[model samples]
Target: MNKIISAHPVGAGLKIFQNDPEIKIHDDVLYIPRIPGPHDSNYGIYDSYGRLVQTAGPRRGWPNFSLGQSQSSSISPSSSYPRATENSYFYGGHIGTHFGHFLTETLPRFWCAPHWYLNKKIICHSGDTIEKLFSVSWIKEIFEMIGLVKEQFIIFDRPTTVISLLIPGASFEENHFSHRQFAEFCNKLGRKYAIDLGISDPIFLSREKFKSAMRTIEGEEEITSILRNKGFRIVYPETLSIREQMGLFCSDRLTSGFVGSAFHNSIFCSSPRGLALCYGNSYSTNFWLMDQVNDANIQYFSTPTLLLKNSPRVGVPAEFTVDNPMDVANLVIDYYEEKSVLKKENEKINYGKKEGPYLIKTKFNSFLQIDRQLGKIHAGSGVGPRIHKIFAYVFDSQWIELFTLGGDVLSMDQLDSVSDTLNFKMQISQNEKTFSLKHPVTSRFVSTTPDGVVECNREYARAWEQFLLISANQN
Candidate 1:
């Protein structure tokens, strides 16, 4: 086996982004291990001391060999192929299908892998080209979005060199902390990738109906028609390209249907407040999905997984039911149904509903500024950059600002109230999927520059001007 020395994690406080991590450089080359074909759900990395690469920061003395990170493996590139040329370029590509597997079972490894160096080559360990097993375009699109460039990917056609190769576990246990961290990271990736790829902005459906898979959801036909009548679009994720799937997921305010890999779309899409994974009794099968959804700060609730006698077992236990689907549908609708009323001005607007003093964050991961301005254009410019809570609520037919980051609505005549200027409301409107935050009492949207610094008084219509309204306590 080829030996790697001075190999350690990139360091602490790194953000998880993609499926392939740049953990350490071996022989002056960075290695991105391949996910074994059969076991696609879990994987990890360990140093020669058998120490699993750690999430603890450098201050914690991470990559501590004393921790015992070693795990057993059966595959060794050294045994199968000739050693890699001492100074030749080597790349690893990763591949997988099955949305559930890809999201929970597959992605977390790459998410937390070291990324201290961005200039190195990143090879995908896909057994075949990513396109062969799944939608090739979609795979490439996701990889690039996560920071992998087309120039960095390479295919190993012949046994030129290799020695020992990294192995990502397929059936390994997923780390709860990492999964949650990655879930939020994946949500950001989904939005950024969709916008970058020009995936059309989504139309928010109160209940997007999707029931195409063969999993026998009892009374599915009736359920489908009922949801359709209730304004849910009959979406089939499998039929749509990855781009289209992302657009629909990112745009939709709420999406629902029988739980399965199809809903894996939610991993990357954060627009929805609640994703109702319909189930009947199989509470155990849904936790992985629940953990993922929760990590993204999106609400997930289960109704029932309906199935009949003699129904083939497909993981989740089935609960027999004959009640009208509308009753079950109420579980989601009651929570998500957007309330509206025609106004005297000939416009439909939010009427009587729970007005959220919700917090706002940019689709790109910046915390919204409440200062009516910002301190630094870039959040990562220094240590402990201030992240404040910026809140909003519906006003004048748009979601207007109730408070900005670091400041709140002035309740008393105290100095705080004077600084906030609560009387002059800031106009906020959503353009497509992005929210445009406007100046207090002006038409200008609260916007920022390419580097994230607040641009003074700019007309906000595009992405840099947009923000997502996450409920209070969501981060």
Candidate 2:
């Protein structure tokens, strides 16, 4: 096998390839190695002291080492590629910078599904790390062909983090300590990744420690009050139902923690803009599955040191100190502003009226007249100078009876008077399949039926009138 420098090392021992017979090293060019047995396919690089640096390939065969340049591969150059423009087309926070490399190489092939594309494009929630990452630059590249910025924009704020507690086990202390460490790691990650705010479950306290900490935080106030005043929201893992916890996570703008199965369950129902921050030192099956699901943005944070040991802790308890939440909050604000500006410019280019004549067909027997000053609908006869109200209501329960009654009903000059009193406009075609109405308070109400008349409830009529009033006020 070709020998390469190891990126990670343990102690003084250098790790090396085993059972690879077809590998060759020529002029510093390392050739692909052929592995023999189930374990033979594994390859590794070691330091001078036999410490392992990096490992690749499976145990049974050679791994594909192509750098995503194969023409036959799904990630070919001709794929729907993002624009190469720098700040205008691509923008991200700290974690974004770290994870950006993977998107460039994998997204074209992996994001082939139309649903994933749609979910990525039309975001319903904003004001979070994921929203900021998407709105600032990536969204522009995807929707540049269509003016996306000109539409109305609404942002929702999430202000809490929920944590799930693990069951007690043999290694409970180790798990608890590891969780604390993970919290600290995430704290650092937030700072580096420019995440402005974070909330996490406080570390479970030992009997002695819990009482001590409680006393210290509260000199005169009750323990709960002091914690609340200090901007802490205490949550018990068992207190919340699964659905409630999922709701919290789904609503959170950004969340970071271990790769717990609970997080997976929560994210399955989360909004598209939700972000799941996973610790690097975990099994990550749920995280991998989440990537497969492609619902929300999943970010994995790992340090070079964590790579040396294949066995990293999972579901550990730890205390994490968040430095500043305002920074992230401000960045989100700026991203939204940029998105708004870009959206407006795009709409101006795409919105225009059609320049051709069009015909409208309907099946109703009644007709309508249009109001010039106020847009509304009214019931009336076909021959009229002013607006008319076209009323179609059924008193009979049976369809035939209703039709007979409607046909035999007397035509009222009072109908014309009622129409005039209401300042209604209406029109009906000779075909008797369609009608329109314009009322004083309500705008035009159009309907079509084979019999030319349609039924309306009292509530609908009243609502229509109210709608017209609102429209008039706006005008």
Q: lDDT scores for all predictions?
A: 0.42, 0.25
**CA RMSD, predictions in order:** 18.0, 28.4
TM-score of each: 0.45, 0.19
Report lDDT (Cα) of residue 389, candidate 2: 32
- lDDT at residue 240 of model 1 (Cα atoms): 68
- lDDT by residue (287-381, candidate 2, tens digit) is 33333233455433221111221332443333222223232222223232333121211101122332211122233223333332332332323
lDDT of 1 by residue, 1-475 (tens): 1111111111212222224333433332222243445443223332333333343110112112212222422232233443444343323323455555555544554554435214444334454554464455665666666666566655444422333333332211222223344556666677665542232322222223443333444555566666666665666666666656655556435555545565556556654433444443222223333343334333334343333655546555443453456655554454455432212221223444436777656656765443323322221112243444445666554535355556543221111112342322234453445566543322344465555565324434566766666777654
- Candidate 1 has its poorest 10 consecutive residues by lDDT at 1-10
Those runs of model 2 whose alpha carbons end farther than 4 Å from true positions after fitting are 1-236, 270-283, 303-475
Candidate 1, superposed: residue stretches over 4 Å from native: 1-81, 86-94, 109-135, 147-175, 179-184, 195-214, 247-252, 269-271, 282-305, 311-323, 337-475
